[model samples]
Target chain A: MIKVRNMTVAYSGQPIFTNLSIAFEPGKITGIIGPNGAGKSTMIKGILGLIHKQSGDVTLHSKPVAKQLKNVAYVEQRAALDLTFPINVFDTVLTGTYPNLGLFKIPSEKDKSAARQALADVNLSEFSQRQIGELSGGQLQRVFVARAIVQEADVIILDEPFVGIDMKSEAEIMSILKRWQMAGKTIIVVHHDLNKVTKYFDDLVIINRGIVAAGKTADVFTKENITTAFSGDLSTILFSDKEPEHA
Target chain B: MRSIGLFIDGLMQYNFLQTALITSILVGIMSGIIGSFIILRGMSLMGDAISHAVLPGVAVAYMLGINILLGASLFGILAALLIGLVTLKSKLKNDTAIGIVFSAFFALGFILISLAESATNLHHILFGNVLAVSDNDLITTAIVLAIVLIFVVVFYKELLITSFDNTFAQAYGLKTQLMHYALMLVLTLVTVTALQTVGIILIVAMLITPAATAYLLTNRLSHMMIVAAIFSVVSSVIGLYMSYTFNWASGPAIVLTAAVFFSLAFLFSPKQGIIFKKKIN
Candidate 1:
């Protein structure tokens, strides 16, 4: 349901993507995968209005996406957060409710209950009182996921939520995404684990400055597209079976 | 040893001493609260820069024969805005931008002050003389404290989320930039108010050390703020005593008192102290 129309995005006056158009399918998990500096994060951030877009508009359900940010949940890369901040897990999760709360108002009891339920959902109830500084990398990622869960967004977009996390935490997060997908929420992820592409994404948008290919995982995540997106000659040797970090 | 008796009598008899005491307490609590946000965000350098950057504003206000608060706050915010602007518009890193802007503003302040040939003591503006604080200065400090208290109470959640993770705040359409600039505005107010107590040079110490000490002692922002406030107030009280009993400058006394607390916390704080580290292991 979210569509980026003829979007051109640049950072510091240098164009990364130009005149690129893509529409993500609703109720499906679409992974945006690419090589280093391939505009995966840039494209999503641009369309979501998180970063500047040189030209274009993004819409959700016939409304401008900017007007409906309340319905979209975006989880940035975990490494971007301040790990030493003085906040506990429960309060961090409670931030999700802030988007829905009106200005000059604090989260109500109902919102607090939602946060509690979210923490329970993510199996972080026991650690709700713990500071984020004490959390393991996997646990911290789960904390953000718990926050997103509490938001109850119609669309969830995450940037590298699985990277650097333990296998169990990765499985836990993917399962939640799967649940959201079943509930008809549009789930868009910036991911690069090629080995799990078939198992993870319902659709794939692979890019190298521009969309090299797009469509269903079975249809577009082929050898030819991989070669083009990863810059063929070197990718043939580098694209091994193991899912090495794509950063 | 010097004159506890005389200092106590002065506290009871002298209006100036009373005003100095009240202003120092207000400034202490104010700096403690604001400093928590600065240290937590890893913006200690920015804190240092903003404080020093207010110097030119004070100098300009003297030249214009206007209120120091008005001119100082205006220039403080301008310096903050320019730092942000240069960083975003160029490839230069944030520290480089801060280094360029604040030092330039400080150097300009020195030039302006010399050109203005003001009657006010240059040493006082740079190093603070709390004993000379007027009743009007006390009133200003109180007002700034009230503003800081109300701002923190009303926008607690907004500031917390933004300070901890700005990208998450931005994702949900919260105006992170507004929160940022708003804090900068408040920082300017605090720095301007602190001029009579901590002065420009040592304001960074007041804004950084107590909050940093609290950071090592607590894991909750609210608790950190409360502890920092207590630590700052205690420093001011003891520092005032030292200033009165001994012939020491008030600002350095207060800052040294804060530094001593930081040292103690660094050595003996139960949860996160170097001494406790060995014991726990």
Candidate 2:
């Protein structure tokens, strides 16, 4: 489990998140849902120690996060990646083992096998040798997921993992997360799709510049809570009767 | 032909040829490895800019009687760090920052050169004389190259991940800022050493051309690095020969040979070459 306390993050003196506090439990799939500019990604980065927090501490299973780096793996938004580099799928996936290998040592046969298995898990085993630039957006996202899986971390954090992916690939990725949860690995995902929030997530943390609601998916997703968290107007449109509320 | 034979015999007998070969190889290998990462991260322009900026550093060192490599590396790293900071901290685009730094530093170097025209051999620092390479320069190049090679090999995985997906690598607890600074330092040292052997104008060609060519030919970093090293060493040898045979400038000849390789890669490389368009129906 990971814990964040009184976390505040700012960029160039512009405050994004202030006094945010939350805990992501172990062995559950937790969805972070919020409208655009809601500090969802910022909170994730703070937890991962990618960005400096003005105030607050993050801990992983009672250890300082900096000392427990190998316990967590993160799959970033696909948009943040450069796809034109001359890297193959296998090499990309193999990079996930870097933390464990540390500096200087090459990947062993065992690491390569784990990478292959991770590719197989994502149904990308056949594309191991293929150039990453030659892959579709969905396939590229899956490759990143395969990398996270290969990391074999206790916790996996993914930022908008399904964005721009087709429906089939989305379903495939959701199933992978379900399996990860089944395997007792904690999964925290930043998601924009409100429809899948209830179906896929065991817990929900609605964030808006700070922590808005933190509880079970069903409890925190109530109409009143959703309305209050999303400023009421957007919630009405999102929860309209014509649109099915849950996927 | 007789003159050519006599020149070859003279080169073989002189210590300068051996010095040039050793120095060129050191510079080439360092640039080749560092250049691969620079191209991978799309920081080829940064490499080019840093090479130019080192001119002021070398000028100042020549004036102060300091070690040229030391002064150049220090200033180059400072300039690179400043560029990185500006790009990361401010809203300025990376290329714009690089342009500003390179122009300002190069102009400063020119001013310093003019001020000290009577006291220094400016050509040795500007377009270096490989034939005049001292033992100390060789030692310094060797040390810098060895350190750079070790760092690259040791952090290959981290570098690969960060270059491909910096956000993800950072999110996974990689110290991406530290990695970026470390890489910039290595690149600065590589460029400085390369400038001493190949001159500032041609250092960029040596830094980027081999890697770019290898990039066209391979889809793997490891293979690309190997091919780049081979290409760089070949170009260095051929350029040396051309320079000796035709009585042309060594720096321009070396860069021209590398450029020739780049053109060949552009024309004949299998996957990304212009001549071999992907079949899309």
Candidate 3:
């Protein structure tokens, strides 16, 4: 299991989560769902030590997760990427091997082969030399999936991996992730689509600043729980392909 | 063509011209190399601020009889950190921090220079005088260039990943904040060494124009670095030639040369050049 305990996270001095705790077990596709400002990404960042936390303990497989970072791979939201950066798709995917190589070690033939294999897995072998700016939204998201595959991390965390991509790409990425689930890797995904919650996630962590409900999707994905977490605002909006503007 | 022979003769005969030529060329190469990263990271403003912030440090160095490199780097780093702290701790934007800190240090520089004896020499810190560069200046520029080359060769991957995506870099346990500060420190050192080749104001141009020109010409960072370095060297060589022949100011001439290269790339680059871009009928 990957666990965060007593995590008190704040953004700009305003507390978002106070003494909150959550655990995501392996071999399950876990989804963390929340409203726009419910701190879904914030909570993930806090636990991973990406953002400062007032207090917390993050552990994976009975070891501190921060110390075992080589076992962790995270693909950020698509919007965080700099499309104009002077790098090709192949070099971008190859950065997944960086943590393992550390500073001063050149990427070897083994690493290059791994990156090439990953690009082929994502059906982007021909696009290896193409600049990232030239890619479609679906192709771009698949590129990141290819990067995570090369990372070969036991724990994978994705933040809104399906926000802008087409349905076909979404299914393609989910199948890759499901294969990881079968390999007993922990998968934590931040997803906001209401209709797909039961379909994509086996366990749900619904939050609005703090945990509203946590359990199997069938048990914790109730409309009452969602309305409470969404704070009675669920009735007005329909779950659709378009996502709310990120807060 | 005849003037080119005259410039070559000047280089072989006058020791001053030799020092200036060597220093200008090395500084040009260093600016291009580091400038690639600065423009890519979108820290061109930060580079400008650091180059300008060195003024107060230069002033203090002159007054205290200390090495200008040590003093200039101190204030340049201080300005960088202050800008970062303000942006992180408050709602103030990056540009605002740059404007406030840079202008304050620059004004202080002017006052201190006015009080110093033979401060006419210090005025060159604002507008470059390559002819005035000493052998020490040449050696300093060379050392700085070597340092930049080694830093890039060693940390190429770290810089690439961090500049491309901070979130991914951080998640993979890279000390992204450290990478940022380390880049800023190297930038400060580059700004300090740039004092003789290009002045504070035009150093920004040297740091930006060649890199921007190369950015237009190539989509790969490694290729961009080499192309930008070549453009920068050509600009400095041509600018120095103009300065020696027509008695134009060295810094402005070099800046203009870089600007001219950028214009050519903007018009005629193969892939991204504006001229061939298809417009909807």
Instruction: Report the Cα lDDT for residue A93, model 2.
Output: 91
The C-alpha TM-scores of every prediction are: 0.94, 0.91, 0.95
For model 1, the stretches where C-alpha displacement exceeds 4 angstroms are A231-247, B1-5, B115-118
TM-score of chain A of 3: 0.93
lDDT score, residue B55, model 2?
Answer: 82
Mark the 10 consecutive residues where model 3 chain B has the least summed lDDT: B272-281
CA-based DockQ, model 3:
0.74
DockQ of each: 0.72, 0.66, 0.74
Estimate, for each residue in A56-159, the C-alpha lDDT of model 2 and write its tens digit.
Answer: 99898888887887779988888776777878999999988887887668899999999999899888889999999888889889998988888888999999
Relative to the true structure, how large is the alpha-carbon lDDT of every model?
A: 0.89, 0.84, 0.88
Which order, best to worst by DockQ? 3, 1, 2
Fnat for candidate 1 (0 to 1): 0.82
What lDDT tens digits, residue by residue, belong to model 3 across residues A183-239?
A: 999999999788788889999999999999999998887657877888555733532
Retained true contacts (fraction), each candidate: 0.82, 0.80, 0.82
Flag regions of model 3 displaced more than 4 Å: A231-247, B278-281
Interface Cα RMSD of candidate 1: 1.0
Deviation (Å) of B11 in candidate 2: 4.2
Whole-structure CA lDDT of model 3? 0.88
